[model samples]
Target chain A: MQLPSKLIQDAVEEMAKLPGIGKKTALRLVLHLLNSDKEQTTMLSNALVQMRENVKYCKKCHNVSDEEICNICSSNNRDKSTICVVESIKDVLAIENTAHYRGEYHVLGGIISPLEGIGPSDLSIDLLIERVSQHDSEVKEVILALSPTMEGDTTAFYISKKLKSCDIKLSTIARGVPIGGEIEYTDEVTLGRSIMTRTLFS
Target chain B: MQLPSKLIQDAVEEMAKLPGIGKKTALRLVLHLLNSDKEQTTMLSNALVQMRENVKYCKKCHNVSDEEICNICSSNNRDKSTICVVESIKDVLAIENTAHYRGEYHVLGGIISPLEGIGPSDLSIDLLIERVSQHDSEVKEVILALSPTMEGDTTAFYISKKLKSCDIKLSTIARGVPIGGEIEYTDEVTLGRSIMTRTLFS
Candidate 1:
């Protein structure tokens, strides 16, 4: 829709650049900002710029950090021998929220999606290999915790092939019905595999 | 949920302050920005700050503008004798999108809401009256195009009372079943009102 003010139009266009935000929603958001306190708007703008300018990535895992080395990598309480590999920082946050896995993580930055022109070279796979090969490294097991997509599986396979010569054991997160999931609604392939790979009760 | 980095947390908190965004959605948007080119983040931040700093409001209509007098108020193509009153700039854009009305607009900035502590004093109601009172002003009709809600009606009623002595006409937008609405699923109050205020075929 046509807007009368150039400043409003400019603000809406910038906001619409965000993912999942359309022009209409952007206009609504901009209008809300226009009506709100100017200091609040400044705070938001400053926060975004500051985050982009001063944000740091972990030297080891590549996750976002306030310093060169992330807190997770420096923490002595974390299980350094077990490393979980995932695609993005969002995945790292998601897994951390679970409070289940005590192991550290290795962010791949992205999966191996040839269709999208992303390959093993585009990711930090080599750094992972280098980290595992170090004689002083205490890593005993590497867990592939990527999503259950074709790209994730392809990346995991490539990594497994690369790590075969190393003494470290390779494993993957279990594929089965999720907790509180109903079997009747579960897809056939997942259900069949879950049944065939059933584990003995403790 | 706990975030690993302070910078990421600050960005997320600032984003979450927006009208409809939650912590989860804010985190997703912030992470998307972090993963994207740094230039895009700078552009967004600059646009927002620039808009907030340079934005202006029309002297006549109080709609967000880039100059003291908005383009709509200065345009000779629009009907100078008719003025459409609205609660916000968003309503002005919505009505302008219809391309049916060629009249000037007076943005009240907000409707009178007691629960929100907003009263007629907080609006630009006096400026609207003054615009209509000036002898040189050719405003023969004032149309109330506010939303069909209690607050809108209250604000309209107050404006009508204030304009009682003025030698001008006051009008309100018609309310009925939406153009393409299903009658069966429509609420009874709106349907009954539509029937009670039925108009003759054109």
Candidate 2:
């Protein structure tokens, strides 16, 4: 859509570049910013720029952090012996929100997706191996907490193979019907897997 | 949700302040930026800042512009004898996209809404009146193309009362069931209005 001002157009175009936002939504957002206080726009712009320029990644797990190591990895309360490997930083946050897991996380940054031209080398898998292989490493188990997608399974298999020689145990998050999900509505593959991996009743 | 870094949290918070965006969506967008090139985030930030700092509004109509006089107002091809009044700059773009309206526009910036504490004085009603009342004014018709909401009708009525003494003709855009809209499914108010204002077939 043609905007009245070039500046507004540029801002809309930039906002549209983000995932899920289209030109129309971008236009609306830009118009909203135009109508709001200049300070609001300035604050948003400064925050984004600061995030890009100053944001750091955990040296070991590649999770977004303000320091060399992420808070989880650096915390004394977190169990460094059990690392939960996931696809992205968002996954790390999702797991953290549960409050059920106290283990440190290894953010893969992404999973192996040949369709997207993302290979194993493109992720932080090598860092995970190095972290688990350190001579003085305290790691005893590496849990694959990735998604249930084919890409997630492939990444899990690849990591398991790479750590086969290590003394640490390798496992994955359970795949099953969600707690509130209706059994009839569950997909065939998930239902079948859940049945096959049924746990013993206490 | 607890974020891993304060910078990420700040960016997410600012983004969430925008209309229609929530914390989860904001985090997703911020993470997408973080995973992509640093230059991409820099460009988006720069564009927003530039738009906020450099954007200007048309002196005549209050539409967004880079110059004091907007392109539509300055264009000789446009009809100076007719002015389409709208609630916002977006409305102007919407009308311009139709390519049917050849007249100039007068953006009111907002409608009179007491609940929102917006009044006629907060808009560009005075400028519009002054423009049409100029000694050598060429304006002959003023079209109220505002929405059909109660606020829109109230604003239109207010404008009509204000321009009652002027020689210019005041009209509103036709309201009816939209073209291609199914008669059976159309809302009662719209259907009623369409029937009441039905025109004779030529």
Candidate 3:
């Protein structure tokens, strides 16, 4: 689309660079900012700049944090013996929101996606091995909470192989039909897995 | 959702404030930014700030511009004798994209919507009247190209009443079924209007 103003066009272009936003949606957002109070735009810009400049990754877990270590990694209440391995910081947040898991997290940064040219080296897998193998480490069990995608499974298998000599138990989160999912609508692979891994009734 | 970092939370909150963006989508965008190169985030933030700080509205037509007057208003190629009035800057762009109209535009900024508490004084109506009534004005026609909504009609009627004393002719954009619209699915009001105002075939 041909924009009348260069400033708006620039802003729209920047907004369109986001993953899901397109030129039309970016234009709508830019126009909204232009029409609204100047303070709102200033606040948004400042917040984004501050996030980009001041945010840090947890040295231990690779999760997004304001400091060298994330809050979960530093907290005493969290179970340091069990580290939930996941794809990204978003997965960490999702697990945290459940409020059921008290274990610390290890963000892999991403899964092993060969299609995207992302391999084990592209992720923080080496950091995970180093973290678990550290002398005087309290880690006992490493839970693989990665997604059920093929790449996630590959990453998990790779991590399990690396941790084989570390004297740590390796486990993966259960793969089954979702709690409220209908049997008829469930995909064949998931349904088959759910049937094969049927749990005992209490 | 509970975010690990305050900076991430702040950015997500600001993003969620935009139209159609929810907290989850905001978080997703923020995470994508965090995972990508820092330069991308910096560029987006800088573009937004620059757009907000430097952008200006055309003094003549109220359309967004980088200067005092918009390109269309300043261009000598446009017809100075005809003025097309629209509700917002987007409308001005939409009409310009058609390339059928050669006249300059007068952006009302908004329509008269009592439900939204917007009135005539809140828009640029007075400036439009003043421009049309200028002693040295060459304006001969004012086209009301506003939307066909009730608020648009009210605003157009209000403008027509205001410009009744001027020597310029006043006209409105024809209301009819859209070019590619299916007749069976067309709304009754639009279909009725189209039939009532049907033009003779040459």
> Which of candidates 1 and 2 reaches a greater DockQ?
2
lDDT of 3: 0.92
lDDT of 3 at A195: 96
Task: Compute the lDDT of residue A12 as modeled in candidate 3.
Answer: 95
Q: State the lDDT of candidate 1 residue by residue for A16-46, as single tens digits.
A: 9999999988988888888889998899998
Question: What DockQ does candidate 1 have relative to the true complex?
Answer: 0.81
Leading candidate by DockQ: 2
| Model 2 score (lDDT) | 0.93
Residue B145 lDDT, candidate 3, scale 0-100: 93
Fraction of native Cα contacts reproduced by each candidate: 0.72, 0.87, 0.84
Clashing pairs in 3: none
Error of 3 at A161 (Å): 0.6
Estimate, for each residue in A132-165, the C-alpha lDDT of model 3 and write its tens digit: 9999899999999988988888988899899999
- DockQ of candidate 3 is 0.82
Off by over 4 Å in 3: none
Worst window of 10 by summed lDDT in candidate 1 chain B: B1-10
Give per-residue lDDT, candidate 2, residue A162: 96
Candidate 2 residue-wise lDDT at A22: 98
